[model samples]
Target: MGHTTGGPDSAKRRLRRELLAVRNALPADDLREAAAALARHALDLPELAGASTVAAYVSVGGEPGTLALLEALRARGVRVLLPALLPDDDLDWGAYEGEGSLARVRHGGRMALFEPSGERLGPDAVTDADVVLLPGLAVDARGMRLGRGGGSYDRVLARLARSGSRASLVVLLYDGEVVERVPEEPHDAPVHAVVTPSGVRRFS
Candidate 1:
């Protein structure tokens, strides 16, 4: 099992590099504005309008910001659950109380992540959510999400399926991140919808 340098893995890695470079180059003001717009559009989704619990993640570095949406969901009385990366790359869940409730955590040499400072509800907690907000680098016209290759979210999706959870799987990205196609693998799953700064696109 040596390192792979071809096929879907290579294709996905190349695309991720290209996308991350663009995201990392964005001005702070533009990122902030995009975050605000993303919040507005995501809040309007019918799937979220009546949701009582949502599984979401905090953005870090070049990722699309989710703090505004997380706050808005909390304000609307939705119980928002955030992920804390587990040692095996599985995610444990915790509630998002507010801005002050997050703790900065660095896993190995990776970027510091903003995670919940409250009680951990275990990985299966995500199955209880009515909606699951996924973080991705890009998504294609067919709803295939291009993830960062961490496999954490892939486990989450599998867990949801095993639990028979009907949570709407959604990804947030910039409008340009929605492209014509993305490299897909057998384990990759299509999302229900994607919320960009400009609008929301539904796949199923």
Candidate 2:
């Protein structure tokens, strides 16, 4: 008998299992209330309020609320850019004008909403952005994030680092998803802060 080798698929299964367990454990009503509070706090933050352009992720799976926050940001005249998954597995950002510009992209067993536009931005775009909200399965108090086994955000954040920009990395999560630690790899990028349904927490 031979032991099964744990490769990419195995890692993905582990991540999927963890996320599923966390989602199942989340308190539905409390999470919703916390999401509303977090949205209010994010909107009122000086960084978010003053930002001319912001990059935010399109949440998938059972992640907590973000639609309301995105709408609120748009209403405040902030230029919102969303990540569009490209064929090469890199992200191409596009302007999010409103609900009118949204189109469907199939992903993760269902369709994901995306904004498709020819406009593309580089790492300097991060320097220009005052705030950027990152998507994650789990985030720790020290700012380390555990993503869905994909290296997309890590690659993008690395580009920002090479450009010497200090854009805020805000990870949106459900309240309990904020934990003491998460399994991390060498290439993983750290977040600056975390936003839960309750409020925003700054991590060192």
Candidate 3:
């Protein structure tokens, strides 16, 4: 009934709508529990093990929470870099000090985002990360991630590619967000793994 096919863009649009519905339908209590479970599972990721610096983002809306994970990584002495949205939809990086180090910023007519308030490093700083945590709406069996229509992370991926970064790219999502398939384009690159509250999935 919804966009079943047509082209990649249409397919993505339909999937986004469907996933958002599922995400927004989560109960507050359930979301809180999921957040804690997500941190526990994500902390067990091999990609994050022994990493000195990890690039991450703050979860907003009903997105799988990363605040706990960030704190855990910091406590482990991992340098956590968070993304700060720029006017051109690219990201600027900043160090995560703690929970109080974040600031809520509303860009134009968009919903507010929790961003690091520390000194900003240029977007290229992400290239130095040993691991990069990505936020997504869905990830397929092949490791391709379906993000919100914003195209922000698309630029981040492009930047990493252009720099020849070897950082392990990981996506944090709820268990149900992992799917059998997702629409993709030629520019789409597979992630190394996906971490859900239930467990972790890796691709070859």
lDDT of each: 0.96, 0.74, 0.92
* Alpha-carbon runs more than 4 Å astray in model 1: 1-5
lDDT score, candidate 1: 0.96
Query: Which has the greatest lDDT?
Result: 1
> For residues 1-204, could you state the per-residue lDDT of candidate 1 as single tens digits?
878579998899899999999999999999999999999999999999989999999999978899999999999999999999999999999999999999999999989999999999999999999999999999998999999999999999999999999999999999999999999999888999999999999996
Q: What TM-score does each of the candidates earn?
A: 0.97, 0.82, 0.96
lDDT of 2 by residue, 16-101 (tens): 68786878676778557766887887786677967888888655546766767888999989988888776655677877777666
Candidate 2 segments whose C-alpha is farther than 4 A from its true place? 1-16, 24-34, 107-113, 117-127
Residue clash pairs of candidate 1: none
Name the weakest run of 10 consecutive residues (lDDT summed) in model 3.
1-10
What is the lDDT, from 0 to 100, of the residue 118 in candidate 3? 90
Across residues 113-186, which tens digit of lDDT does each residue of candidate 3 receive? 99999999999999999999999999999999998979999999999999999999999998888999999999
For candidate 1, what is the TM-score?
0.97
